[model samples]
Target: MFKEFKNFIMTGNVIDLAVAVILAGAVGLVVNGFVSDIMMPIVGHFAGGLDFADMKIVLDEAVVAADGTVTKPENAVMYGKWVNAIINLITVGFVLFMIVKAYNKTKTPPAPAAPAGPSDNDLLTEIRDLLKK
Candidate 1:
């Protein structure tokens, strides 16, 4: 059982999957950073410097006591963050699509199979012709 488990873990498919998972995680982080840092700023600049992350709908205002500090936090719907996430998702998808496209372009196509040999009847006919010669 232990040997079987070891063999399973050492299989090419499992190793490939593990490597792919790690690469995907790294790609996700890079995409997230690109979206949050680079893309969002450019978009914000074009849209009059509006920050998407801060955009929200306040369902309930914060409650304040006699002190200046708020007694309760504000209840709100963070639609801006959702928009940001959507943008990030789209960017990641586009990046992956481009990667697949490039990989496909670099991939070598399979060679065509060789033609099959002549049939039994054809071979027998050729043999008969040679005997006559």
Candidate 2:
């Protein structure tokens, strides 16, 4: 059982999958940074300095007591964050699509099949000549 487990862990497919998962995580972080740091700022600039992450709908206001000791936190729906997330998702998808398209362009096509051999008529002619000789 231990050997079987070891063999399973050592398989090429398993290693490749592990590497792919790690790479995907790294790529996700990079994409997230791109969206948050670069794209969101540009979007905000174009939208008249509107910050998407701060867009929210307040459902209930917070309650504060005289000493400010007894209080309730504000309840709100954060729709701006959702919008930012959607933009991030779109950007990541488009980038991945472009990457796959470029990769396909670089791939070499399969070699053409070998041409067919002599036809039946040609074979018959050769046989007839051999018989005559």
Candidate 3:
């Protein structure tokens, strides 16, 4: 069982899958950063300076005591954060799609196999007939 487990872990497919998962995680981080740090600011500038991360509906206002101590609210609709997440998802999807598209574009089909040459027997027969003639 130990050997079997070792073999499974050492298989090419498993290694490839591990590498793919790592790359995917890295890509997600990059996409998330690009969306949140770069794109969101530009979008905010255009959308009347609205910050998507701060957009929320207060279902219940926080309770404040007389001494300015506050209690956390029980519920709220954080629609702005949702919007930001949606934007991040869309951007990541688009980026991945473009990457796949570009990769496909650059890939060339395998060249067609060269036509088969005459067999040795056929060549030998032709030589014999030519010699007889």
Candidate 4:
């Protein structure tokens, strides 16, 4: 059972999956950074300096005591962060699509199959002619 488990862990598919997962996580971080650091600033500038991450709907206002102490609210909808996430997803998807398209374009088509060898009857006929000579 230990040997079987070791073989399973050493398989090519398992290694490939591990690499894929790591690369996917790295790509997600890059996409998130691109959305947050680059795209959002430009978008915010155009939309009157609106920050998407701060865009939210407050269901209930915070309660403040007489001495300025405040209690956190229980209900709220955070849509700004959702918008940023959506942007990241779109950017990552487009990049992946482009990469796949370029890869497909570079692949060489399979060469045409070689013509079949001469039939047995054709060889036999040649031998028969040679014998007659």
Candidate 5:
């Protein structure tokens, strides 16, 4: 069992999967940062300082007692955060698409197939020429 596990872990597919997972995680972080730090600010500025991260529908207002000993937390739907997440998803998808497109452009196409063997017509023609000679 130990040997089987070791072999499984050493397989090319497993290694490739591990690398892909790591790369995906790193890309996720970069995309998240780009959306939150860069894109959101620009979007907010264009929308007259509309901050999606702060958008929410309050369901219940918080109540604070005079003595500050009893309090109820606010209940709200954080739609702004959801909007940000959607934007992040879209950006990551677009970025990955562009990357794949660029990478495909650099790949060498498969070599053209070798010319087919002489056709029957050509063979017959060659025979006819030889006979005439």
Candidate 6:
């Protein structure tokens, strides 16, 4: 069982999968950074300083007692965060798509197969024609 596990771990597919997973994690970090740090700010500027993270529908306003000691927290649906998440998802997908496209471009296409030689039947027909001539 130990040997079997070792063999499984040493397999090319397993190694490739491990590498792919690591690369995907790295790419995820890069994509997330790009979306949040770079893209969001630009988008916010374009959208008239609209901050998605702060966009929410307040269901219940916060209740405050005397001296603001006892208070009930606000309850609401935070749709702004959802919008940001959606943007993040789209950015990640687009970035992955571009990476795949670039990787495909780098790969060399398989060379075309050499043309096949004439068949035996064709050779025999030619021989027969030559004999007749």
TM-score of each: 0.85, 0.79, 0.79, 0.79, 0.82, 0.78
Q: Model 4, range 85-107, lDDT digits (tens) per residue?
A: 88888999998898789999999
lDDT of 5 by residue, 55-106 (tens): 9999998888999854898899999999999999999999899989999999
Any idea what lDDT model 3 has? 0.94
RMSD of 2: 3.5
* Total colliding residue pairs, candidate 1: 0
For model 1 the TM-score comes to: 0.85
Q: What is the lDDT of every predicted structure here?
A: 0.98, 0.94, 0.94, 0.91, 0.96, 0.93
Pairs of residues clashing in candidate 5: none
lDDT of 1 at 40: 99
lDDT of 6 by residue, 1-133 (tens): 9999999999999999999999999999998889888998899999999888899999998888889865898899999999989998998899889999999999999999999999999999999999999
**RMSD (Cα, Å) of candidate 3?**
3.9
Query: 36-102, model 2: which lDDT tens digit per residue?
Result: 9999999999999999999999999888899986489889999999999999999889888898899
Candidate 1 residue lDDT tens string, 1-133: 9999999999999999999999999999999999999999999999999999999999999999887899999999999999999999999999999999999999999898889899999999999999999
Clashes of 6: 0
lDDT of 6 at 22: 100
Model with the higher TM-score, candidate 1 or 3 = 1
**Residue ranges of candidate 3 with Cα displaced over 4 Å:** 114-133
Candidate maximizing lDDT: 1
